[model samples]
Target: MTAITADAIAFRAARDHLLTHRGDPAKVGASFRWPRLTQFNWALDHFDRLAREDGDAPALWIVNEGAGEQKISYARMAARSNQVANWLRGLGVRRGDRMLLMLGNEVALWETMLAAFKLGAVVIPASALLTPADLRDRIERGHVRHVVAGEAHAPKFESVAGDYTRIVVGAAQPGWTAFDASRAGSDAFTPDGPTQATDPLLLYFTSGTTSKPKLVLHTHQSYPVGHLSTMFWIGLKPGDIHMNISSPGWAKHAWSCFFAPWNAGACIFMHNVARFAAPSLLETMARCQVNTLCAPPTVWRMLIQEDLAAWRGKLALREVIGAGEPLNPEIIEQVKTSWGLTLRDGYGQTETTAIIGNAPGLPVKPGSMGLPMPGYRIALLDAEGREADEGEVCLKLDDVPGEAPGGHPGTGRPLGLMAGYEDSPERTAEVMHGGYYRTGDVAQRDAQGYYTFVGRADDVFKASDYRISPFELESALIEHAAVVEVAVVPSPDPVRLAVPKAFIILTQGSAADRTMALDVLAFARQALAPYKRVRRIEFVTELPKTISGKIRRVELRQLEISRRERGTRDAGEYFEEDFPDLKS
Candidate 1:
């Protein structure tokens, strides 16, 4: 048996405490403390220990559509990662070296991640959906020293010039090393030195919905140990089959797929489908007996479109969660009516773990993303930094000296937060100043401490002196039957300066014409308050989205601004004035 480090024991104790009190949010929040460790390597200390003890337990399960599945046990996964790590070291990969990892949901992705962790190298996760321009930007800005990508993606790097080592996971290409050759390397591995808890581990590029992608850097402890909050939020248990719907290049993938599930001894389940079909996804989940499922609001919206009740009898789901975006109350209600389970919502960013979430066994208020997770000290602060009922969501950075009112007893810096935005001190300082890390998101906290998402700070606009949250309006508009997806932005108005204008993607079989726009505008008039009502509607086939599937409202807003300057109206756009029927 391999000896465990003191750091591993401390981490295990912390993890066990959360697992033991998983159902009791208050107890876990009040008593749970992040393990203070000086030297720690999660893959070496914790995961290897779990593999040694439970060698036969399934660690990863991947099911491909129309293809056979792959199940890797804990022991085999460890040995495979060791071989990969040894091969990478032979290729001159070293600690602190930045490696750009771009691959699909194949088993190689997980193996390379573990191998990188064991080597103490920093990983820059990129989406397979990225274009050559995107890859050029990431490689140039990220200071990449090595590249590991799928054979299908090799052509993208042909135009990308860099000194980085190129390795391909599938068919071998000239000038690129074959990833399969790593299997020939020795399975036994040894580390050169101890990995500090603060050593850089992962560097993530934000989805860039509003602006350029910012490089968010995390340490060894931030993600591997920080995801304990995410584990609590998803209500994971040992031996449970956990499925998280996310792409490989994004942060949420790591939050649920890699760290959180492993932290709880749960099997990370993946269903690889070329296209997303709600019926097929639910059927697979039921057949696989997946216990915990976390998906984005987009996926939830599609899931609600399917006959959820029909699969309820076949499913073994114990908990369901929504993240990436705020979920609509109507979707929540529909799922509850069908599955008899609360679809909890959670909020976090690429810069941190699950900072705020509706944990398991907690009473979920509709549309609220729940309270602060076990280690977070969330404060809604106004523009002046004063605590407000509704303001930007910020996490307190410095520990309070004593028992501050409505605050946790002086826990130091949150273990989950990133070290800083890589190489951008100005950007990091902008968000991390004033003793708080501003999330750039706005939310309102009710008296009971439930935080409801507003919109992105910049996405929130004013119309006729009244503040309008695009999310609130979008949520209301999404309740309409004709609407499939919507993005609400302020349209230029002569009388009110600016009014809410909705760009909507209608449901299947719905016409994108004046009649449909009028109907949607009338429905919005009825669904929203007078000031918040969507005054104009534009029926569209699609909304601009990031590669990660987040709606890019910033682009729509910019388009609206340009159109207003040009004094032109988009085709299929309808104003409430055009329909006197809605002029109540």
Candidate 2:
């Protein structure tokens, strides 16, 4: 009855509003503006206030192996994070300082994340799966000043030289601070000052499939506020439990698991495991009452392979979305047939939040990545920078400096765009040229405003003067019953310059022999036109992927060139000669 603080009232108001307006996009979008505060912090302004007297509100939920579960309330998390903030501050962790956080989906991960946010330190989230070399590169390039990792990871850093404090989350070691000791400090948090909206909040080292990793920087406002678009895309509401299938260290993890859902006042549910089992994951989703779900195309492909009928009847999963890459139309149709749900696909890079997405309540196009978000202005520009029906994807920037959001008249600039690639202004200039931010990906936009993702700018190739999108061919290949995963690249030919070739990974109970390859090729020919027909096929155990799980088509392309040069006999390579029954 103390005239509840502003932060508490905001939290309750926002949460209740989202609950009352669930599935009502117009109502929520019309009223939900990011809470603006000149002297505000998410931890101090919202999280701490929600924690006050909210002893029963579940804030963090973790499900470990063996079905062991742990639930922490808002009050408990607030107190624990305050202690961490105090303890970290004692170790010279100050505002704006960069800390490399490498851990699994543990409670300490969330605790330290909140504490860093409260103290206004920039966090570089690293995956626990990274090798020592990866860690060394991150430490050297990321300008990281501190590290928080598990005791098991400490030995990896022993050989890497750094001038930062080591805060181990598990057991205490010599010259290493134990995360448990944070509980001995004060529970009360006192920030040195208010956090600036433009101050750096997170730095992510992305898994570069084509080049070295780039440090993508985000501010407090960028991810936290920018994700308003992402929340809207998924149509998440307060009190809804959202489960995102992603590793802890990747940008997608922060995109869905951390910022997006939390921005919508939704609870984050994490299922920690050593490896993914589709049935077990489905069971967990059913048991946890996961309302909204998001995963990559690879996971969806695996899920579709399972007996989906066994898990489809569950009603908690109201919204199903896909990201990380385009959702093939075949997967979408399969989900619709099995579960009566449409898997919406969203598109964005590590530099931004959900810029383009198939928003909830909209009619979904099977192969398109959907329309641009509310604040986005997308353009398909030709090589000459003129608007075209199909070309490279570019975000138009405002002609005038410091213009209004989305720019004034005649000024169309990319909003929610990255500041620049850290320490590489030349590289930044390459992408951010002529007032437009080039995505380096190609796409085509129909007259109806739907955008379909073509292959990467480098992956799209010309075979006999016809432009071919490797993604399109790969998507077609994935539809085959025997194909588990596939990557399409251009193989050099004597007459046609290059031809579409597929490297396939077979599913269980399916053979990767020449017979199976021919069967898949026949299916592809029946499903696709002659122009897009896969000319050659090779079965491989695994497709090369970046650490983030994106197929490295460049690597495959180079391998194809070398194979042609050396005339290598691929494991399951099949050519027209193998099927010479057809007329020439």
Candidate 3:
């Protein structure tokens, strides 16, 4: 058994503090202090310790649709990762080397992540969906030294030029090392040296929603220890089966799948399918008796379309959460009505861990993401950087003690925040200046301290001198039965200068014709105020989305602007004026 270090003890103490005060956010916020450690390697100090104590306990459980299931115990996982680390070291892997890891939700993904951490190698997680062009950009800009990918993704590198080492996870490919060969290596491994708390560990490429993807760098202490707050927000407990629906390569995957549940001594559960089917997913969760579940709003929206009440009786779910986007109030209400559980919403960015969330045991306001999590001091700042009721969401960077909402004393810098954008100091400075890290997202805080998301700073526009939030209009549009997905953008108008126009994807079997458009427009007229109503509708097969599944409103806005300049209208577009019988 590995001897636990003092740093690991401090980390555990902080984690246990949150577990003890799990039900009281106010108490946790006021008292919790992030452990100050100069030398710490979470995989070695913390995870290994857990493995030593609970060797027989299950650490990872993955279920495939027709392929059956795989359960790995803590002891087995630790030894496998140790052997992989030793094998990789023999292949010239060392501390600080950047390795690009692109694989699906298979066992190799977990084994490689742990092994990379143990070997002190920096991992740049890439989605298997990445194209050759995407891989080329990541390799050049990320300064990658090694590549470890699944066999299916190996052919993509044929067109990508790089000098990095190539290793494949499945059946051997020519010119690529077979990952299976690592089994011959010994299961006892040792680190080259002590890893500093601030040493670089993971480099994530942000899903390019508005512009090019930026490389966001995280330290060993930032994500590994920073996710203690994430565990608290999800209300995880020892032996609980926690499942987070997120694709690998994104930061949220690391937030829940890798760090958060492990921090709480919970089993990480995954259900892999060829494609997402709401009915099958719900059934699996019920069969597996998953205790806590966290999914993006997109998945939640799809799940609500199925008969939720029928499955509620068979499920053992205790906590449900929505993330990746602002959840609609209608979905929350429906879930409560059907399952008797509050669908909590959490807010964060690729740049940080879960900063604000409707935590367990806290009163959830329908449309609001809840108060700041422990160790975070949230401040809404206007354009001039002054505190405001509605403005850009920002985090205090200074260590000066201040009072947060509910009279909780604000701590210093949160360990969850990223180190900075790699190789882009000016970009980093722009967001980290003014004694705060600006999130670029705007929100309004209520008097009672809950915060409701408005929209992206750039997505908010003006119509007839009134400021408009596209998210508000989009949320309202989503409530319609025929609307499967929607992105609201400001369309150029001769009279109002700009009006809210919706790019909509209709539900299956719904017609994209005049009758449907008029029906949706009438529904919007009754549901929203005159200024906030969706004035124009365009029925489309699909809306533009980022690779990570976020709606690309910026692209839609640009499309509208280009159409206006061209003096043309889309084939499926309908104006409010066309619906003469509909009342505004």
Model 1 residue pairs with clashes: none
Instruction: Write model 3 residue lDDT over 25-81, tens digit each, in one string.
Output: 656788888888888998888887889889888899999999999999888889999
Candidate 3: list runs displaced more than 4 Å.
401-410
Model 1 global lDDT (CA atoms, 0 to 1) = 0.91
lDDT of 1 by residue, 325-346 (tens): 9999999999999999999999
Q: State every prediction's TM-score relative to the real structure.
A: 0.98, 0.92, 0.98
Give the higher-lDDT candidate: 1 or 3.
Answer: 1
| Candidate 2 all-Cα RMSD | 3.2
What lDDT score goes with residue 344 in model 1?
95
- Supply the TM-score for candidate 3: 0.98
Kindly indicate the candidate among 2 and 3 with the higher lDDT: 3
What is the RMSD of candidate 3?
A: 2.1
User: What C-alpha lDDT do the candidate models reach, one value each?
Assistant: 0.91, 0.80, 0.90
